[model samples]
Target: MKMWFLGTGAGRPNKHRNVTAIALQLPEPETGWWLFDCGEATQHQLMYVPLKLSKLEKIFITHLHGDHLYGLPGLLSSRSFDGGVTPLAVYGPIGLKAYIDTVFSLTETALDYEIVIHELEEEKQGIIYEDGRLRVEAGPLVHRVPCFGYRVEESDTTGPLLADKARALGVRSGPLFGKLKAGEAVTLEDGTVITPESVTDGVLRGRIVTVLGDTSPCEMAVLLGKNADLIVHEATFAAGLEEKAHEFGHSTTIEAARTAQLAGAKQVALTHFSGRYSNDELSQLVAEATAVFPHAIAATDLSMVKIDRVHERRAGQDEISS
Candidate 1:
């Protein structure tokens, strides 16, 4: 998985950052990429990245804020023109569906594929998306609007089967070997039992990532971020301006770092910076976050990042561990 930030500014777009859009490129089983938020002019930003609209499988909107959704309609239309035939699934708060419906209706636009919208009720919580490979949950975040934070968890994969050991044990290639590879115990013709534990190497831990919209330091953000490999939180202001940020339902760099620390997340990416800050000022923002969480860093537009992978190696004969 890789994250590409298309826009990362608060309130409006600047030469440095745009509003708020992020593209997460996932591997096999998942098509193109999943967009976090479609802020204004997000499609234009795609030129800097390798993502194509035709490959977008899903779109998760954090809120109905203009900065988070204004570019959606255009992206949708352009996607169709760009040969996006795959059905798109969009999830968000209550007004999300209505907003998209109204926009498409008003513009009299048509697309090549169907769109399935999953709208969450006020403060709704629980898994909003789940499949064989991915599970996404929504938790309400503290903001002026009914904003949300999303937690994306991937499914774990079984480790490779030790074919060499099996062959050495006289377990010839056949159905028994297939069963053993699938973690099933097999009784050979010799009446000896072979278990998956004796043949498998390890369990690959799935990745977890949390991406939040505009929000203040809140418990929901912490809940979604818990144990996440990466926490993408807003750093709309510097440390000393906590009061102002709080007033606007935003968070400072320090607060974002504190959330990552409290959530026990492995890494943090600070985004949604205030336009007033130039590159130098943004450095201070990253510094404050890193001071609290060593892995914290400021994310820039078009910068790519990956989640930390955790693999559990099978341990002793009695118990398997990572």
Candidate 2:
């Protein structure tokens, strides 16, 4: 899976960054992408990416904050003009349905496609969404408003069939091989039972990615990010501003890294940066985060990061780029 940062600034947009919006490009067989937070001007940011509104299947809002979801109405409206006919499902905290309804009602806007809004219960924590291919778990986060963090887990895939092993075991490359690959035991013409475990490689473990809303470092954050391949945490301030960050219900770069460490995550992407830091100064946040967790990166606007199933374990590596 790949993540495209549409906006990375906190609270408001600046010259360098927009607000907090991220587009997660789903893997194959799924042609669409899932949007994280839809901050102000998020649709404008989408103009620069390869993503399309028609292909947006699911949208997960971390909170009801303006910086997190102010762009929802415009984006949803624009989708109709952009030929987005597929039904879209939006998952968020309570009051979300009312917010969307109020906007659409006041604006007298009509959508060609259906918009399904799911309002999560207050402080509810568990699987919010699940399908045959992916499962999403939501956990309450410590924020000024009712906020949440999401853990997206891809389903484990079957490993490739060992053609050489099957051939050696008198298994022909026909329907018998297909049956064995499908985890069914097949009896060959020679009366040899071939089990999938004996001929195929082990299962390939799926990847887990955690995306958090604006929050102070909390135990729930750790729980949502536990053993995640990548955790996208909000680092709204640098290390020295921990007090200010927490006062605003936000996290410092150090706190984000600590949460990643406590959660045993493989990598951390620090985002939701404050506009006080200039473009060049954003590196300071990355430096502070890397001090506590080596695999930490400061996400920049329009940057893209690829999350691999296999952990690279490289320290101080900047894998994301604009």
Candidate 3:
């Protein structure tokens, strides 16, 4: 799993950054990308990365703010023009469906694929999506609107089959091996029934990623991001701008980092920057976050992060997750 920051600026666009947008790249089988908060000119931002608009599987909107959603109608419309045939699903707070319907209806733009809309109103927290390899959860975030933060956790329970162990245990290439790899008990041709735990490492490992939309520091946000391999939070302002962030229901750099630290996150990436900050100012903003959490970083447009492996263990526990 990997994450790419398509746009990181908050509220509006600047020469160095655009508004909120992120791309969560999952593994093959469900290899397409999931988008969060398509800011204005997001389609243009796609040009900065190796992303295909046609490959977008789902879009999650943080709020109805123009900077967060102005690119939606244009991107959805362009998807059809770019020959996207796969069905696309969009999840967001209420009024999202109405927004899309109005735009598509007024423009009379027909899509080559299906568009599924899920409008969330209540305070929801649960598994919103699961595609064998990846599982997505949604948590209510404290925002001006009924916005949400997403947690994309890779199911570490899908341990790969130990081929050498299977061979050593007298298993061969056939249905038996397939069944065993799937955590099932199988009988060999010689009438020996082997359990999945007998020949496999019996350990499952995968990555966990949490992405928070425009939100203020909240308890639910910290709980949802606990122990995440990556936590992407909106740091819309510097320390002195806390009042601005609170007024807008956004977060400051230190607050974001503190949330990551409290959540036990391995790495925290501060994004969704305010346009007022320059390159040097942004660097200082990152330093503020780093003071709270050493692993914190300020993400820029088109920045990519790959999850190699995560090792979690107590002092006396064994080394794992390689």
Candidate 4:
């Protein structure tokens, strides 16, 4: 799995950044992708991405803010022209369905594919989506509007099949061996009960990624991001501007870092910066975050991060992101 940022700036578009949008792609267990927060010009930004629209399976909206959702209609309409015919799911807060329906009704937009809307209710906290491989959990967040934070968690995979050991144990390569490899107890013809414990490796922890919407520091953010491999939070203001940040229902660089620290996150990725920060100024803001949490990183548009890979944060400047 991998994540790519389409827009990292907050509120509105600027020469430096577009807005809030991130793409999570799962290539192996069948190539598919999910989008988080389709802000203005998000579809245009996808032109630079190598993924196909048909592979886009779901879109997760954090809140109904214009900066986070304005581009959703355009992106959906353009999906038709891009030859996307598969069913797509959109998950968000209660008002999301009404907003989409209103826009489509007003524009009389024709859709070639089915759009499934999952409206998350207030105070609802549990798994929103779960297949055998992956699970998504959404919880209410503190924002001006009814916002949400999302946690994408992968299931722990089973260890490698012990084919050689099975063969050496006088077990033939067939259905019985399959059962043994599945961590099941199998009694042989001689009534020998073979346990899979010794043959398989211990369970490896599944990767967890938490993404939060615009908000002041809150317990929900820490809960959603607890012990996560990555925590993606908005840092709309610098450290000294805490008062302004809270007034706007946002977070400063220090607050974002504190959230990550409190959650025990391996890495903190700061995005959705207010337009006031220049490229150099954003680096300074990253410094403020890193001072608190050494693993803090300031993300930018089109930057890609692989979930299972180890990455180093550069000291002097941001990593090469395009």
Clashes of 4: 0
| Model 3: CA > 4 A from native | 158-160, 311-322
What local distance difference test score does each model get? 0.88, 0.90, 0.85, 0.86
**What is every candidate's alpha-carbon RMSD to the true fold?**
2.9, 4.4, 2.4, 5.8
1-322 in candidate 4: lDDT tens per residue? 6888999999999999999999988747569899999999999899898777778999999999999999999999998988999999999999999999999999999999999999998877889999977899998888888899999987764354667876777677788777866668677789877776544444434678998988899999999999998899999999989888888899999999999999999998899999998767878999999999999988888888777722222245332211
Residue clash pairs of candidate 3: none
Model 2 scores a TM of 0.92
Top-scoring candidate (lDDT): 2
Model 4, residue 134: displacement in angstroms?
Answer: 1.3
TM-score of each: 0.92, 0.92, 0.92, 0.90
Candidate 1: where are CA atoms >4 Å away? 170-194, 316-322
lDDT of 2 by residue, 1-322 (tens): 8999999999888998999999999987578999998999999999999999999999999999999999999999999999999999999999999999999999999999999998888798999888867999998999999999999998765456889988998988989888876778998777878888788766556789999999998999999999998999999888888899889899999999999999999999999988888989978779999999999998899999987764222245322211
Query: How far does residue 4 in candidate 1 sit from its true spot (Å)?
Result: 1.1
Give the per-residue lDDT digits (tens) of candidate 3, residues 16-131.
88888898876655658989999999998888887788899999887788988999999998999887999999998889999999999999989999999988765978887887
RMSD over all Cα atoms, model 3: 2.4
User: What digit string (tens of lDDT, one per residue) describes model 1 on residues 1-322?
Assistant: 8889899888889888898999989865465789999999999999889899999999999988999999999999999989999899998888898898899999999999999998888787899889867899999999999999999999887677888998777788889778886668888778988877787777767889899999999999999999998899999999999999999999999999999999999989999998999766777788888888888888888888976456577665333333
The C-alpha local distance difference test score for the whole of candidate 1 amounts to: 0.88
